[model samples]
Target: MNTEEKGLGSWTEREREELLELGHALFACPELGFQEVKSARILEDFFEKNGISFEKGLSVTGIKASIGKKGGYHIALVADMDALEVRDGENAYPFHSCGHSIQTAVMACVLKRLKERGIAEKTGGQVSFIAAPAEEFIDFETRAKLKEEGKIRYFSGKQDMISKGVFDDVDCVISMHINGDSGGPLFDINSTLAGFMVKKVIFRGKASHSGAAPHLGRNALHGASLAMDGIAYLKDQLPPEAGLKLHPVLTSCGGTVNVIPEQAVLETYIRANTLEYLLEAGEKFDRCVTHCGEALGIETEIINTTGYMPFAQSQEITEVVHRQMLELCREDQIVKNVVSGASGDIGDLGYLIPAVQFGFSGAEGRIHSAVFSVGDEENAYFRTARVAEKTVEAILSDPSLQVKNPDFQKKKEFYLREWLGENRE
Candidate 1:
């Protein structure tokens, strides 16, 4: 590896190449959340090849790999193993448009380096290579099935794992995601992400033959149209800093021109920065659906399956990573940044630990669209590994820095109570 002596550690040339190759493979095979079979197996193979042990079969597609054992202050590192559901020509329905595959590859590379250099032995603690599933919140039906079967109670991969007590032994959680553009200063930390809830609304009515007796049909399409109209009008009355977002996609629109529609399915995500904003905005959206359903004389059912809370980064952990990026990744590599109101499962972890989510961009394409591409050879991967290594060293070197979570007691207790299906009030 090209050594940049910034008082931080470096990676070997072999290490860099291995990381690059991992990125290439992972970027190519974009697996959706919860169904990241290939992605999970590939990472599992890498860990097995490296002689790291883990508690596999945790959440169908999630793997809890660990390094180091016995008594010490343990820290958890997460690499979300799922990709978004986007048809990018090569891979239909699932693709790496979000660049999480690269993020996972780099995380694996970091874990490997930590083991090869015996950093864990010196630190006297543990590190987890948690390949979490269903980070995208795309497959709701399957998640609902998993919950029904007692396989998982929570729909989100991270939330489910947490509900299963996966991080009980962990102190701090650290994870990074690939972002957009290069050379821009990466976000050192987030105050919190915008929180959101996933809602699936199904409008049901009586269908009739369009050409034969169209007037006899109870039009579910009219109800769906009204619901959409409400959403279009709702965009203006949202809070400024709260950052409300409403993305409703028409998943199904009843029937063909020959038939009068009986069912229309609409899936939407309601969001805001604070829980108060989230609840308030969600209420308005809820009212729109109910009122629209009433107006069209169609029964509408809403299902809220997933919720991603906001995350607040620990100044303690970020200062070290931010410093490493600044010194190691060229003179002006690291810059100040804030939360972009994106929703994620890491927020669930942040409620318990002082976590930081940071990374570099993989591709230059527009993020969620079909052209979302992972610029395979971006310097972000190697630089990210180096930063992680540097951060690990910093954590291991300092005794007063501490590895304990800031909100462990309160959050864990609350979640534990929730898991038991008890009232938390």
Candidate 2:
């Protein structure tokens, strides 16, 4: 790709430097989910300096800045603003192992460039830059406390935004993530993602002295262990195409070693490729856990929470983006139609309107691991932003480009009622 042909010739050196500086600033202080105080402030300051007015505190820390008028074909460019907790030796700290800092920075750069070039004025359609919070599902304890205080109703940030009518005016969504696996290609388009449901189980039994009267007590820990074994055995029966993944962790199993465990808590996620298959696998999983605890003469209680819907990329939008990718990368350097088991809240937003999350290669090391770092800042931060900006311009310039827009309210109600069992008025 030559300089002019690369489509990056228009990007000024100052803009390029600003992109790297913003990425590095975000990477320096990685904050989790809704607690991204410093991270949010940095992006907010950037928006202020650029003269972009934004609404903050949507999902506690999520931000939205809109350009152009609201009535036309509205589009949103989403950037997740949360990081994972990585452990080093004996201590654990928040880090951008998932490269969300790159997403935030690139989107910020795209928004700034679009505003500077007055692209939105040409299209007469709105372009919104959304800094979404709590894409990562970890830190449940803190989230639960927030829930008790009525700060948030859903664990995922996108769900909360949906319930709060954040995307009510938005027509579609375009987002990107940094692909840690650089072996694939520079860009990946139209990849599918799995959806998952959060599961929590509790087993209760009578406590007794282990040394004196072990036989009189029903061990809850034994029940949990048996339930995990049952789940492991059921895995073989599940179809491979379903992509069933169940990995339960024992969060609590008694307090002392001398007494028989009277309570055990297990938490996991049931993930699958489609909604029907996800529910089917969830039913089987529940039965396995419930029966296993019953067999051990322990009382079992299970709680279910909606995680995310399966992500099916919009083919029409993807084709448009593919043309943009071909200009910056070789034909062979773009991967298409790959399926992945990883889940993201973007899937939830896809249920209401057309959404596509393209992947760009620039990072190395395993994602969600401590060693993950950006190896190619040019591709991760600069090139990816160019493709995103170009895609937006293409979509906005061609009013003929269209995708199926589902009934926003009906779908939102169905998601909240059928999937989440909540009937919000």
lDDT tens readout by residue for model 1, 133-168: 878867778777777887776777888788787887
lDDT of 1: 0.75
lDDT of residue 175 for candidate 2: 96
Task: Per model, state how many residue pairs clash.
Answer: 5, 0
Q: Provide TM-scores for the models.
A: 0.79, 0.90
lDDT of 2 by residue, 275-311 (tens): 8888888899889989999998999999888889999
Q: Residue 153 in model 2: shift from native, Å?
A: 1.8
Model 1 lDDT-worst window of ten: 416-425
Give Cα distance to truth, residue 400, candidate 2, Å: 2.7
Number of clashes found in candidate 2? 0
lDDT, residue 417, candidate 2: 85
lDDT of 2: 0.88
lDDT of 1 at 355: 80
Distance from true location, Cα of 29 in model 1, Å: 2.9
In model 2, state the lDDT of residue 215.
Answer: 96
